[model samples]
Target: VANKGLKDLKKQVEGAAQDAVTAVGAAAQQVVDQATEAGQKAMDQVAKSTQETIHKSANQASESFSGFGKKLGLLK
Candidate 1:
């Protein structure tokens, strides 16, 4: 009877340990998901800013190129 009681107690402890591990894993996954979402949001904002910068730079470069072409008598 004592040996059987010890076996039951061991099983209960093992089960609780497994449950705790599963909970930790679930919490970590939630954190990772949230972080990924935040990172993607930040990346999107950066991309927008970069695109705007590139567009402005391209406009300025084209204007300069057009001026140069006019000076070279290639364009009116």
Candidate 2:
């Protein structure tokens, strides 16, 4: 009977250890997922900002050229 009790205790300890490991792994994965999501959002913002800058620069260049053309009497 004592030997049986010891065996049962060993099994319980092993099961608990496995559960702890699984929980730790899940927590680590969650951290990684959050980090990846944050990085993607930052990248998206940078891309949007870059597109806006390019659009603004193009508009400025077009307006400047139009003004120059008028001054040269090449455009009405």
Candidate 3:
């Protein structure tokens, strides 16, 4: 009778441990997904800012050269 009781206890402990492991695995996956999404958003913002900066610089350079040409009578 005591042996049977011990066996039942062991089974319960094993089942609980398995459940805990499954819960931890699921939580870890959620954390990984969140981090990946955040990283992608940051990358997108960086790309947009870089493109805007490049366009602004190009416009400035074009205006400067056009004004210089007009002053030298190379352009009307």
Candidate 4:
């Protein structure tokens, strides 16, 4: 009877340990997902800013060339 009781106790302990490990694994995965999402957002913002900068630079260069062409009488 005592052996049976000890076996039951061992089974309960193992079940509890398994539950804790599963909970911890789920929490860790959530953290990793959040970090990945945040990194992607940062990269997207950087790409947008870079595109805007390139557009502005291209406009300034075009205007400068147009003005130079008029001064040289190359364009009417």
Candidate with the greatest TM-score versus the true structure? 2
Ranking by TM-score: 2, 4, 3, 1
- Residue 3 lDDT (model 1): 100
Better of 2 and 3 by TM-score: 2
* Candidate 4: residue 51 Cα off by (Å): 0.8
Candidate 4 regions exceeding 4 Å error are none
Model 3, C-alpha of 10: deviation from truth (Å): 1.4
lDDT digits (tens) for residues 1-76 of candidate 2:
9999999999999999999999999999999999999999999999999999999999999999999999999988
Go through the candidates in order and give each one's C-alpha lDDT: 0.99, 0.99, 0.99, 0.99
**lDDT of candidate 1?**
0.99
Worst 10 residues of 4 by lDDT: 67-76
The whole-model C-alpha lDDT of candidate 4 against the native structure comes to 0.99
Off by over 4 Å in 1: 60-76
Each candidate structure's count of clashing pairs: 0, 0, 0, 0
Clashing pairs in model 3, backbone N/Cα/C closer than 3 A: none
Give the lDDT of residue 17 in candidate 4: 100
